[model samples]
Target: MKKIIILFVAVLLLASCENQEKVNKKADISTITAESITQVINELNASNSGIDKFLMEKGVKHVANLWRDSDGSEEEFKAFCKKNYIADVTERELVFQKISRNIEIITGNFNKITLELLEPVHLNTFEQHAIDNEFGAYSVDSHWMNDFYQNKIAFIIALNFPPFSLEEKEANAKEWTRKQWAYARLGDYFTARVPAELLQEAGKAAANSDVYIMDYNIHVGHLTDAAGNRFFPEDKVLLSHWNLRDEIKANYANTNDGLEKQKMIYQVMQRIISQEIPEKVINNGKLEWDPYTNMVYENGKTIEATPEPNERYQQILNNFHANKAIDAYYPDQNTFIKRQYDGAKEISAEATEKIFTDFLRSDETKKVGALIKQRLGRDLEPFDIWYDGFKARSGMDESKLDAQTRKLYPNAVALEADLPNLLVKLGYDKERAQWLGDHIAVDPARGSGHAWGGAAKGQKAHLRTRISEKGMDYKGYNIAVHEFGHNVEQTISLYDVDNFVMNGVPNTAFTEALAFIFQKRDMLLLGITDDSPQKEALKKLDLFWSAYEIMGVSVLDIRMWKWLYENPEADATQLRDATMQIAKEVWNEFYAPVYGVKDQTILAVYSHMLNSPLYLSNYAFGNVIEFQLEQQLKGKSFPTEVDRIFKQGRLTPNQWMVEATGNDLSATPLLNAAKEALEELK
Candidate 1:
């Protein structure tokens, strides 16, 4: 589950200085020329009659590329391949199966070790010691790749199961059997040889970012206005920017001071984004601050405060440098951008951009925005992008919902106990629901909750949800259900899949799609069902509006990464300026007309932009996929259909869509639905 949604730290940790040095030391080995590679292929094929010409050429070339000075001269390379290459298809398959099984065990245990080590840092249990931080920062798999290379396991896998390019997979995957897909996944193992030291450094950088974001809370109640008026409750502490954003949405139901609170929260977000916030105000309750005027005071006395000094952007820059270091090893998928798209997501960046752009620029976006404006009885503000009116529970008072949720789930254990019943409400049989629930373990999260899927069979997927001592609030419960959906998907795809290699969905977007599905149904789980005639229409409008907001953010994220690549040497301050510029440009082009505002920097306020790095797109993609899947689930058994579709495992995104929904991924469904809903609403 860790790899499903979170960044793949295990893979990143495989990059080390040892592998770089190893590659560097063999730089002078010019004996293995193209002609020599060809000759080696010819000799191998001649000696092993069962091995075809194509296999011979691919295997020899693969081994030759990975060959080092320690791997011996050109003759020795040829001799090793000739000796170890399995000529028979059946024999080669057996070798692949063996390797795959061993890798799953090794990698699974490594994931378990990592989860244990990082628990103190990741979860809010006790005051974290320096040793705890050090342990959390450690990457257990840092030396695994280097060790593999030294033991020749990497070369063996590469020589036997040659890698297929993304193009090759896309072209032939639809025709491939499950076994064939598994083989291709096996081939993905040793494509890059980064060193242990670099991998460890990357892990440390990511851990630092995680800790920074986790501890970034605001004492919302301590915020004061010009007249020293406090709008929030004294005990209310919210994390930036998820909890703060959610609080803004929750205030939409409050007519008395909703707008004021929302405006104040927006101001807080802007300061964070611009790095103009006072250093002492973040996660501090000792001082009262007025976000609008940027004033800090203790007991009614104004105090001088320094700005945050661009530390947020510094983490992003560090991540960029760490990721950029591994580019040289991935000659084919060199950049982190390429790795995210072609390597990790297995979708082209061009395709993702096209999907987002076409949807954002469509007439449907304008129609939806106009509808929101009409509902609000005024023009849209920047924060109206997060308007929650279309949801079934939007009209219900949040306090009532919170009261119900806190009573139902008094703690993490309470929610964990109810997972089976929740699954049952989603249409699973009692026995199956119990079985599925048994595979997931719920815990109180340090930050806003995230679901971490188990890495191997028999491992329980961890569902972390934020729960206060009083109980789980409405916001926490909603997020818990969303993460529970991820846990269910992770449990199914890993434990029930046809093969170990193909254990997850195509990408994080797919998992996010499922999570969104469950999140929209949080009310149902709480025994609150909407029987409104406009329910379907409201759902469509809601999805369209959500997509409209996030697509702009996604575009901003994509542009920011592109800018970073263009200005790789940029300092944190320069990066901050560039980010603000990009945010404003995206806002003006896409959101200005809708909101009646230009040059807004609110789109740059996402914490993921600094911590998660290039993750905003997945949320947009998830909405699109969720809309499509929602359509497919109509007039069908929900649990049965979800099981059938998700069990398809990690196919290419389009192919997975085709098999699951009888259509490829497209915005046409959501846009058309929105148009119909607009008509219905009118």
Candidate 2:
């Protein structure tokens, strides 16, 4: 109001001056002091921030649309800068044509985003930029990549796995496991290599942004969730998954030089579903375990046995064991993705008992029948499903019982500023932690509560986040942990890229490896551990079990889609049928063999298929690497030695594994974690 009043008075004074030229001269001649200029800049940003956000979103859409073949002849809308131009004399209109003739990737000739253009560019400096530009959307792409690949190659050299050149393929279990882990780790390394040059170019462009605003588009545009939608996230799943075919899952099935990651991973899968600790899986003595593979054979005489250790069960496991679906994607035991799989699981509704007493057994929910009648509350809507989940987590902060995180890192300008100190506490040294401190920035923007991505442009990179905000109450905090992993990579890669092109990891999972590392920080933050609290045991079980749950869904995603592709005749209905069958198959193999669960399709609620193509694997990968990194940090601190390791930017994923943990990123961490949990349960 005061500003408006002042403006009105200024306008009146200007109006009283009969000459417009004089007013213009006065406005231009008046010099603003530095403090006033800073104030104005802040105020202007506060007012125009919405418009800026709107433009960024539109820009992202524009970039996504540019990947399409515009008219079937490999022509795309925005594959390159528009150059041909002409002007009309009287109307002052400009006419132009785009330069998009040579690009084939945008025309869909390739489905993955591998920087294949640079695969052969090793040793040649002059022609390297050529390949980088071809693979990158911008020019500096080569600069970032050249350095990134070197680190990957160096790491691979150290691992000393025998190379597979599509020739000498057969290998033993141990050999195959080594190969599977390497390929899985390297797929991202090479893929990220392709974009190294692109990001390098992007950073350069970002630096000269103000002068090039008209030509360039936006960088980090996010979307708003619709009333019935939170179904998607910033479309990040898609963006992150965009070039997956060339990255992590390129040779997804044939893990070790075409031997098979599925087979290696599957070896343990069998143990999880059927291995027990001396008791049968029973729900009130009911015997509902599947009897397919759980049989006994003595001296060539076969006997149908109860589901037990060392026995296989059902079609999914049987098929996997037999190499039928060995190539399938299975993230966990309980949840697997099959397009048609109606995967579901059960949990107790917190208010079920109260609802049943009032006889308000409407169509709300079988569990919560009385909330509407007894307490005047509404029906058990599906949206309220997470009420119990959030409450369980947020309940920790019943009072202002927590200290402000900023107190720990007084040097930090934001909450993210606290990351270094926290890292040191968890195990980082002060200097490296401070170096990390310098690279990150906390935006305080309303993030969906995930740690969010870090953007690196020019010599500096900044990390921005919107944690501790609305809707971010607890779930957001959990996500904040996971996101921190992503931002750490962003900070490391952007600020510490080897040659600028080789400055970051090779793929989403490479960053995921780090984010996975950071996410473990939450328990560290609360000072909780293996012996912390009674509830921690249950929470840990939920965490450990949830990974198993997701493993099934992840497998379903890989398998069902391949099934659909195999059976082109199948529609949505056919797809769903095959999916449900796979779900039940998996349940019988893992859960039924132990917990006795069946016909559960709750896994379908996962948003990946609706948004991303091959993201389920990342969660599984995170769990896997979490084990590796945690082992590395188990006794030592991070900032003392790890932050520099994290800051090493362009290390191929494997190199990072060796440098950070002195081992390969593998299933051992997670497998050990699970094994430990099982032992405790005993």
Candidate 3:
């Protein structure tokens, strides 16, 4: 599934990864001086007698950093800190428990509200309207930070449980208790006092971009070649770029027309990337388009058509501006790129870049590309980056699979009913499978599928996927399987984990790892097992190639954002041009030698670029994690291992991987496996 990040969950999962930098202009609003902060800390420790002097100093300094003129005068700030800071261990534990419970209540209900409001915009249950967009864009919890500050709840949390930087968390995580981790997570909540209006604006921008992406469908059946040859069924409409990309993958099974269809689809992708596609043809079946010539026809007559305005790039800029608006609020992690990489993923941008580039430049990458070219009996096209030939179902007729899936899942309800059974097929006991199924609510989606995890226990995680009027097709089923993996991880991490504050994986990549695990087993769940002797080799090759493909795209995503930061004032057209150039540059570096082609813009066609900023790396990282976990699960009980690993819950990526697989997160395992797989296949 082409997934969208659940931003609400992401916000709550912030680990506040940076120490307070020197007070900038925005942070200079604080009236409390450093001398007053030190005086308070010393006074609190002196009175408490046995208090942790380290926490006293850290907590006072932390509060002062967040303190503003509105908070109080210097004396008032000192008094508030002394009064609220809990020094006794027993009392501190009690306060932590209470704070954690109340936070869950506030955040959980806010999530429910957002989910309900977005139902019309996100789900297929209702017709979309302007009002739906307005409601969807509304951020109910935007005022909660300000409200918490007014009640001194924010200050209390900050003072009692001082925020830890990524370095501190990693260094201390080995020795800290679970409760200490929870305390650090709570401290993460108030590190930034961004105004409610800025939060609402960012939320509005994200929602608008999502709505635009959800509705951006391409009427593929209306697409024709120069001789007026139409390849797809008349009713076929595919959304860009999820369904369109999937369509290319599906055509790999079409023995006769597969290459031709792929080339045509590639042409269509180029048009979309260049914004040369006719505006009238988007989401409209009334007009036919010859993507090759950038010409449109109405009722067999050529019609003058205007290309789509740079609305795609405009969405990118909208998100950029929204992020930039609140940049000043985050003193340590000022840029959205920094916040996303350092705060959200808990991995530095440079480290992530090195990891991806290293894998892209691996000898195994070239070997795999060479093997793919050999399998195809020809040179690879740029679209061949998504070549699906390694999987068991690769050459199997997709129409047959669609027919099977359609019959099995006639509607969303049918699939929902079978969730437990699917789990059973994966070695889960009946009771456990039923429990998981009961907590996951499946819904038909308007866009490509995504998994929205529950914020609190007893709140069901949502699995949303596209279902046609006729039934669920193979593609939808495949996506649902992937999303089902997310729901399983969600259920495990929230309901089974040790801490309420640590109720998710380290990042979305971890959840995506679990999702990939489930997706690889879709055919098995249907009793179509791959018993090939070379199955292990194929699996390794599949993961290696998948990682190679997305890592390149991930690199492009990073570069594009870097470009945006460099050219903050650039408009849509300029941004579009820059993005295309970056995509080509990335392609040339990693893919040109393999494909025997250069300057292909196919990597830029991911829908995520416009909607889900900086999310492509998660997919690449997911592939890496998935491979490592797969290796670990080699001889272990699948259900038991999955339950155990995911329950580790919100540790740093490296820590979680080490605990789960007894190895750090690295491309070496995958690359080594691919090398061995090559030997076996040979």
**Which candidate has the highest lDDT of all?**
3
Which residues of candidate 3, in runs, are more than 4 Å off? 1-29
Per-residue alpha-carbon lDDT of model 2 for 1-682, expressed as tens digits?
A: 1245878889767753533333334322212233433343344345443333322232222222222122112222122211110112222111000111111122212212222332222112224343343343333233433343343332222122122222122222124433243332222222111223223333333222211111111111111112211111222111111111111122222223321222221221232233321114211122112122332233334434443332211222222222222112111211223211211111111111121212111221221223212321323221121122211232243112123332332221445656677667766567867776666554432212233333324222333333331222223343455666676677666555433333455345556656756664565664654444444333443344434555656665565556654664544445546766775665455444333345544344343543344356556545555556655765664644455565554333445567666786555445455445444544
What does candidate 1's lDDT look like per residue over 128-200, in tens digits? 7767777888899899888998888888888887777888888987898888788777778778777677688
- What candidate 1 gets wrong by more than 4 Å, as runs, is 1-31, 50-52
Model 3 RMSD, rounded to 1 decimal: 5.4
- Among all windows of 10 consecutive residues in model 3, the one with the lowest summed lDDT is 15-24
Q: How many residue pairs clash per model?
A: 7, 49, 0
lDDT tens digits by residue: candidate 3, 59-117: 88888988887787888898898788887899999988888888888899999999999
Root-mean-square deviation of candidate 1: 4.6
Q: TM-scores of the models, in the given order?
A: 0.95, 0.41, 0.96
- State in Å the error of residue 661, model 1: 1.1
Q: Is candidate 2 or candidate 3 better by TM-score?
A: 3
The TM-score that candidate 1 achieves is: 0.95
Error of 3 at 461 (Å): 0.7
Model 2 global lDDT (CA atoms, 0 to 1): 0.36
Give lDDT per model, in order.
Answer: 0.87, 0.36, 0.89
Ranking by TM-score: 3, 1, 2
